[model samples]
Target: MSKRKQNLVGYLFALPWFIGFSVFLAYPLVASIYFSFCDYSVLKKPVFIGLDNYRELFADEVFWITVKNTAIYAAISLPAGMVMALGLAMLLNAKVPGTTFFRTVFFLPSLVPMVSLAVLWLWILNGEHGVLNEVLRMVGIRGPNWLGDPAWSKPALVVLGVWGVGNAVLIYLAGLQDVPTSLVEAAELDGASPWQKTRHVTIPMISPVILFNLIMGIIGTLQVFTVPYVMFPGGSPARSTYFYAMYLFDNAFLYNKMGYASALAWVIFAIILVLTGIQFLLARKWVHYEAGR
Candidate 1:
């Protein structure tokens, strides 16, 4: 085969992915950008209304409420999940009996389908007949309405978020296993306590993985949906659990405000981009790589 034929063959192999990207990803993204500037309803043609959707979003009180709710959830859940996951990973990283079994048990929650998990948690956190409240009742303490009260609803969702930190645990476990033994041994020789070994050696070595998990956790928590949607339906009591993604979903589907939804989606995209960028920038100071060492 000649050079041109080989080139053609390579292009043929890449064509499917290129076509899919154009049709599925690129086109929709471009369309959404256009739609964001328009007044689009699913049933009717989109009318150009530059910045109207954005202006409405800025003026919309519920928009700010959802933003606040989403930010708080992400802020709390991200760090909490990271801490839980890292602790679990460290525990399992120890040479204990049945470590594999314990790892599997802890990681199993993440494998449960989101819808099923949501349903299970609904029953578990039920105000009256739930297992959690029952335990509290047995201990002579009454549990608050987890899914009902505005104050506790977001916290209940945070618990659910942390339960799925099994995924992060696995990631951290991998990072822990990859940490250089020589460094740990050196720390041990210097009379470093276990906590000191972990703080001075293990954690610094796994800083990259920590950064990775932090970024992913931030993104996931910010885009949290199904669980809250299933548990609370539209919005929780006083709209306390009305997250940004949920509100965006309502705008697009329930209210037939595709333009507003598009704007909201772009805003979310921008927020995620900015946050991830900031994380990367800050990682330079604390996230030590082997190359840096």
Candidate 2:
């Protein structure tokens, strides 16, 4: 076949996805960008307000609170969850019996629906009648009002976030398996201890994967909503766990401020874009790729 015919065939094959992307993803994003500058109540028409939505966001206490809470949640969960995932992956990578069983046990939590897990945690972390509190009481430690207290709500969500580390662990495990064994053996033969070998060889080899995880973890945590949204039953006791996405949801749905919500969504998009850009800028110094070198 001629190259022109091949090109036409490829275009035909990709037609559905291209059409869907244009209609669903691209159109909504463009529409939201337009809406962000307007005031729309869904029932009525949009009136252009020029940056008023953004101007109002700066002074809105709830917006700032949601930003702070979201930042804290992302900061706490990203590194913490990634580290836990790496540790679990390392454990699973070791030669041992029942390795598959352990992997299965650790990963089972990720299989459960987020809504279901949040409901389960609500019952288990209740201030008085919680299973977690009961366990703590058995050990004579007073369990704080987890969902009721603003101090504990975000932290409790972070704890719940750890349960999702299984997905990260699975990714890290694949990376670990792909690491070059020769480098490890060479380090070992040079009288380097296991710790030294891991620090020098294992880590560097998997640095790309680490970078991948770091970026994805940051993005995922920044957009976190499910655990906090459902666990607290309306932004927690004092809006402590009210994430930016949750606030966006409230504005769009509960309050019917679609235009403002679009503005908030765009702001989130900008934040994520900046963060991902920063990660790319910094990756040059630390994220090693052997093939690239």
Candidate 3:
């Protein structure tokens, strides 16, 4: 084909994807920005309202509650999950029998559908006749109502978050395997204890991986929805389990406050962006790169 004709053919092939992107992703994003500044409901046209939505969001008590809940949940779950995942990965990386089987067992939970997992945990964490409580009772201890009490509800969800760190464990396992054997041998020759070798050599070598998981855990924990939503409907037990994303969803759909929801969505985007940027900034001091080193 001639050059111009070939170019035209290529454009034709790309046209479908370009159109889809403009109609779906690009347009919605732009529309959401505009809508955030207006009073909009899906059933009616958006009316420009200046900064009213944002002002209202700041004053909204429930919004603040959700923010506080989300922050606390992330603060507790993120580090705990990372530590547990790393520990499991290290254990799996050791020269132990049935390693493959154990790896599969750990990873299998992550493959379960989110709804199913939530429902399963719902049963497991029930206040009465639950497997966990049953075990506690076996040990002559009375278990607290995990989902029925506001104080324990958030912690219950944290447990679920930790349980599903299988994906993070796999990532850590890969990073662990990539550590230099020579460096470990040198540490051994220097008479470093197991903890010293791990702290001085293995962790530093996997610092980049740690940074990746930390950023991902921050994002995931901040946007937590499914399990809590399913297990604690309407953030019951006094809204202690209510999270930012769940509130956003309720505003958008249940309350039909599209404009307010859009504003909230933008705020969430900004929060994630700022936090991720902070992580990247701090990573410079700790995350090690072989090439940079």
- Cα lDDT, all candidates: 0.94, 0.91, 0.95
What ranking of all candidate models by TM-score puts the best one first?
2, 1, 3
- The estimated TM-scores of all candidates read 0.97, 0.98, 0.95
What C-alpha root-mean-square deviation, in Å, does candidate 2 show against the real structure?
Answer: 1.0
Clashing residue pairs, backbone N/CA/C < 3 A, model 2: none
Candidate 3: stretches off by over 4 Å: 1-17
- Model 3 agreement with the true structure over 1-293: per-residue lDDT tens digits: 99999999999999999999999999999999999999998999999999999999999999999999999999999999999999999999999899999999999999998899999988888899788999999999999999999999999999999989999999999999999999999999999999999999999999999999999999899999988888888998899999999999999999999999999999998999999999999998988898995
Candidate 1 wrong stretches, greater than 4 Å: 1-4
Q: Which tens-of-lDDT digit does each residue in 249-272 have in candidate 2?
A: 999999999999999999998999
Cα lDDT of model 1 by residue, 75-153, tens digit: 8999899999999999999997999999999989989999999999999999989999999999999999998999999
Residue 215 in candidate 2, Cα distance off native in Å: 1.0
Q: Report the alpha-carbon TM-score of model 3 versus the true structure.
A: 0.95
Determine which window of 10 residues in candidate 2 has minimal summed lDDT: 229-238
